[model samples]
Target: MLFTKGGDGKVIPRCRIKPLSAKNVVVEGRDIDVQTFLKVYRQRVHGLRFIFDKNVRRRSDLASEFEGRIVLTLKIASSGEVENVQIKLTTIAENSPFSAINEDVKESVSHWKFPKTKNGATFSFPISFYMMLPQPSMFDDSSSIKNK
Candidate 1:
């Protein structure tokens, strides 16, 4: 998804998600090719996101609502275990609501798994969170209707 801040009261995401470089993908011991592994790895990681929302709500560091990009670099072992997850870049600030999402993001990343390969692989991907902003009422006197 791509995002661009709009001057005319609109929000369009303009971010690009790049697949892992072929040279970075390895499947020595496994029977699958690099392309197939990449597909599977992506699917697995996206599926893991379902579990993140539930865990994130428990935290109160900040209200987790923002429209921006968060890129994460991950290293996976040959045994399908995630070795590391690092914040490559983020358009949102840490003091913002994104801080509340940090633990949930880590928790989600930890659950990502892939088939065992002869050697582990390292790659990066971006996850975008977006929502529409609330607009003010069209009429200023609308509140007077209820007051009467």
Candidate 2:
């Protein structure tokens, strides 16, 4: 049980703030708050993935050989709109050709849609990119010979 200072300066159990209801969901020791948090988290993750995929498709020229992590902080409004977006290139390599990847992700994430809540919230997450290399054609053995 969690305790907090009450209005009268007495330590009160935090759970006293809200009475349990029949509609409240609980799993293990978690209460409605945990369930709500999980729902919101899943929704936000799904939205981010959708936005990332859409933006990646728009930038087909992104280098596939580079691996990097982009950290993004988003301020989401209660109306489910993205209010502000902050991008930090946390794992970019020096003099990399994909220097603009962070900007690209930032621009794409700005259009992300999240579930509206009763109050606005701030969320920060890291997006890691490990692009797959294009497969060489099996019939293109002549290209290898020419290089040798």
Question: lDDT of all predictions, in order shown?
Answer: 0.54, 0.50
Please give, for residues 38-81, the per-residue lDDT of candidate 2 as tens digits.
45544445444443344434443562443557666767677767
lDDT of 1 at 29: 36
Top candidate, metric lDDT = 1
Candidate 1 residues 1-148, lDDT tens each? 2223347744332212244555654333333356765676577544434333333333322212434566777777878778788877777667754464555666677777677867777766666654432234422346665544
User: Could you tally the backbone clashes for each prediction?
Assistant: 9, 0
| Segments of candidate 2 deviating more than 4 angstroms | 1-64, 93-95, 134-148
How well does model 1 score by local distance difference test? 0.54
What TM-score goes with each of the models?
A: 0.52, 0.49
User: TM-score for model 2?
Assistant: 0.49
